[model samples]
Target: MNTVLRLATAACLAVSGYLHAQLYVGGYRVIPLIGPSFLVQASAAFAVAVLVALGGPFLLRLAAAALAAGALAGFVLSRTTGLFGFSEQGFQPAPEALLSVLAEAAVLVLVAVTLYRVRRGTRTVRA
Candidate 1:
């Protein structure tokens, strides 16, 4: 993938990760011990952005995909747990939960597009 697109994708993932981390501090059930885990995962996204900015296109795509998948799983787990937290007041998803899911989905798409572009570029150069 081109540098611009890769960097943009990484940036988006970073922002999403940070937003997801916010969930833990806003009257949620997150344990104090879980904070570091969330921070590390979120920081990984930002780290990938920095890595891509430093010209790690090949590695950035893979890293973004892995991060996106991990975020998706985390969000799903959150959603399931949310069910237990629900009551007759109607199911209220944690703040930014939906947005986080959407952002992860977008990152997944970006990863796929980047992979396809890289593969196409390679094939064109080879031919």
Candidate 2:
């Protein structure tokens, strides 16, 4: 179960990384701070995905969770208030935005389940 959760979470992160990288190359590269941020996000997501896929410890899961949550927050801000002085209407750039959101959300859910499993494993019954 733990292995499955790790792989699923890793896959989610990888999908998000791929989407962001594609967006960066597809012209977001000219968007100043936002451009660099996307690149960093892609890199981090890929790295964490690799670690998680390799059965890394809980710390790696924590990092993956953080990365996914951060991406989702950025997505929301970019659409709502603004992110790096940039705002966009409903999931612009076709399906990538929507896909990325779904992938990040999945990562969060998978990580949450992983957390529960780990916590449950560490619990001890009364004598």
Candidate 3:
């Protein structure tokens, strides 16, 4: 179960990271301010995915939680309140956006479960 969860989390992270990174080439031209932010997010997310894939590390778990939460928050804020004055197309169920959100949410869930199990001393997986 731990292995499965870890892999699933990593997969979601990969997808989310890719989506975030894609903004560099896709939307960054329209919003130059977001380019740097997308680069940082993509790099951090990919690094976290690699760490989680490697195995249990206390720091990795913390990073995973932080990155997932941050990604989700950024996504929601960008879609609703419009991050940096650039709002998304307005909650219209865009396929790409939906996929990214779902992946981020999954990562959040899996990472939280992993953290809980680790805290309770019941986790069999390293991460």
Q: Which prediction has the highest TM-score against the true structure?
A: 2
Candidate closer to the true structure by TM-score (higher is better), 1 or 2 = 2
Candidate 3 lDDT tens digits, 5-113: 8878888887888887886667664566667877888888898888888785757756766777887787788877888886676543366677877888888888888
Sort the predicted structures by TM-score, highest score first: 2, 3, 1
Residues 1-127, candidate 2: write the lDDT tens digits. 7788889999999999999999999999999899999999999999999999998888998898899899899999999999989989898888999999999999999989988876777784422
TM-score of each: 0.75, 0.95, 0.81
Q: What is the C-alpha lDDT of each candidate?
A: 0.68, 0.92, 0.77
TM-score of 2: 0.95
Q: Candidate 1 at residue 14, lDDT?
A: 75
- Candidate 3 wrong stretches, greater than 4 Å: 91-93, 122-127
| Per-residue lDDT over 31-109 for candidate 1, one digit per residue giving the tens place of the 0 to 100 score | 5444555677777877886786677857776787788788677556555663334321222354466676677787788
Strongest candidate by lDDT: 2
| Evaluation by TM-score, superior candidate among 2 and 3 | 2
Give per-residue lDDT, candidate 2, residue 42.
Answer: 97
Pitting candidate 1 against candidate 3, the one with the higher lDDT is 3
Clashes of each: 0, 0, 2
Error of 3 at 21 (Å): 1.5
